[model samples]
Target: MTLAIETFHYRLAHPGYCAIPGAHPGQMVGSGQLFKRHESLLASPDPRRLDLRASLLDPFNHYRVKVFQQHSKIDVLVIADLSASMSIPGGATKLQIAADFLLSCAQSAFESGDNFGFIGCGHGIEKKWLFPKGLRMGRVQELARDLSRVRSGQGGNGLFQVEPYLPLRRSLVFLLSDFHFDLNRLSRLAGLFGRHAVVPLVLWDPAEYADLPEWGIVKFQDSENRRTRTLLMRPGLKRKIIEAYEQRRDRLRHGLRSKGAEPVFIEGRYEASALTNYFLQRVV
Candidate 1:
């Protein structure tokens, strides 16, 4: 699908999240008018946020930004998991949530004039697909539109092999996903740690980490499969389950730390506001 973009009746300098210390961003551009764009997943057009989400967009919304000014421009690569198991229900799918985080990153990149691009990967690509490279303010929407259609297909292993695209030289890359996959992916992840600045985003739902209400027997289906599994949830069992979840989380964190790369966590409840706030505090 093609993207449609025209300078709105209004214009403003778009700053990303916030300016880095000692890094001076450029000018200010106010909100522009609303317009329609075909989203990646749905059939109809949706209203794109031109400027209504100003607060969420940190320092950028108010100041000017210097594009790609870094002696070595941060190569911003946004990667998301489209694996089927990652399509857990609660709020948005993991892929969509990743897209939102990436969109925010893209916005910041655009304003800063950084070398930005993105790749939405899953099982495999038929025909061919383009991994966007270079900062283009308009391409952020193009990415959201593309991401809306990501399908999580059921398979023996929903996890993907993300090794080939690694060792980005002096670049900052963010890999956002639920990461309920095989540890085999980590060998390559280690290489990434040695070479690039990798920010790992861990997406989770409350149900995965804690117990729901003690509302009696709950019929639940595995997020990876459609089959239903009924299980009784008592207070004791709930505590045990939560403990086990915590243990696993600690293990994951330990593993990443050992290999390198600090993981930033965001739960489904974060929504866009919390998500943006986290980015501002961490990456911006």
Candidate 2:
């Protein structure tokens, strides 16, 4: 099915370490607009960048060549939770939102001359949903379509196994999940992703907590373990439930911040502009 994808602008706060030439500021010297420093012609060996005035004024009479920081490409990977909980629908199904976000990432990465990849994790890293970093927009679109049709059934423990699949170099990783599982697991995952820049997109539905009726019998099910519980809802009980959700949000935010990751909580729907604003306000 066709999906409406919205692209967002992003930038690395620090110089990228990739050797491949692309669009972001990099640590390598190459053909770029950002002038780094001047080097001896023998070192840089690029006559086109030779500074005539610097060459003439050299006390040692050595030809000085201008060296500019080379622009580089970084792998942009989306590590999504494909657990049963993610199948819950709010304004949109969580998986559908994830698919849309993936499409946007692919489009944005391509526009920025970067590579895009995706990994969907459930009980383990789902091989059917894995893609290595590449610049092909067609592959991304195809993958997004496939993702939209996925039937989530398992838990998200596969996230622990994702380290091997990730790029050895630093990358920008977008972690999409409702985070219904234990926060301790998230903390561990945060440690595993320390080498990469991680952005946690906390997907939540209002119906799960906020939209509950204050006076009625409520039935809730454990998506991961397939357990169900029925509770008599009242003002006091509803308040407690809302407070619990609020506490979870606080813990999530604090935990992510302590690990140097900023979490973006999407209560009902996904917004590309919110993500763009996040990068603008926090990444720098």
Candidate 3:
């Protein structure tokens, strides 16, 4: 679907933007950057930024002042899951959905003048999957190209590997994944990300649970191992399969909440408007 994406504003404890004088230039609730056009000398009153034109034009040269854009930029990171389960057949794969989400987020970040980075986690932290901090609008195009060739790999434990590279200060992190890993393992990983503002983007496909024939001998293949198993899809078994997915969803949501992170569940397709709403709703 044609999706409408929007950028959002979020308050952070640190987000690397401080009011105090810092080495890095960023948007924050801090004192930095000089404003153009001297409206009031009482504000900037900077002798260095004295606007001679306005000073000469002023009837009394009493209101010459400089204006400044006083917004701090925060880093935004997108951590995507590249595990085999994300490559499920018969629908837009999880990676495809994740790529779209990342693109939308990148657009939002750029519009807000924030830096954006990306980490595609699969089988471990591969060098190819790391997109370092960048702020240009073209960064999203590069990310999209990289994602176009990426497929779900056998790696499933990459989430735990992300903690080391996380931003030192508080940041807005969006983690996209199907989360088919061990519950205990996922919980621990969530705790690691709890240090920052983490939003888990849980991707699920209805076909993964609801497309099985009511009665048939279906051969299911494991994406990671490439192993196949035949199971009779009886009516009772179908119901159980669907129920299990529902339970899994609940656990994933609860786990994130318990760890001080929020979870957004996206089923089948990725809708930019819905994603935007999730961010807006969480603005408290």
Q: What is the lDDT of residue 109 in candidate 2?
A: 89
Per residue, candidate 1 scores C-alpha lDDT tens digits across 47-123 of: 34223443345444442221222122245676666666666655556656666666667766655556676655565
**Top-TM-score structure, candidate number:** 2
Candidate 3 residue lDDT tens string, 72-164: 667788988888888776577777777777777888777666778988788888887787577465666666666755764567777788888
| Model 3 worst lDDT window (10 residues) | 21-30
lDDT of each: 0.54, 0.84, 0.73
lDDT by residue (1-284, candidate 2, tens digit) is 23666889998887889899988899998989999999999998989998999999999999999999899988889999898989865566788888888888888888888988888888887668788676378887878777777775787888777888888888899989888887887666755458889888998888888899989988898887778999999999888889999999999898888888889998776778998999999773
TM-scores, all candidates, are 0.64, 0.93, 0.77
- Selected candidate, larger TM-score, 1 vs 3: 3
RMSD, every candidate, angstroms:
15.5, 1.9, 6.7
**Candidate 3 overall Cα lDDT vs. reference?**
0.73
Supply the global lDDT for candidate 2.
0.84
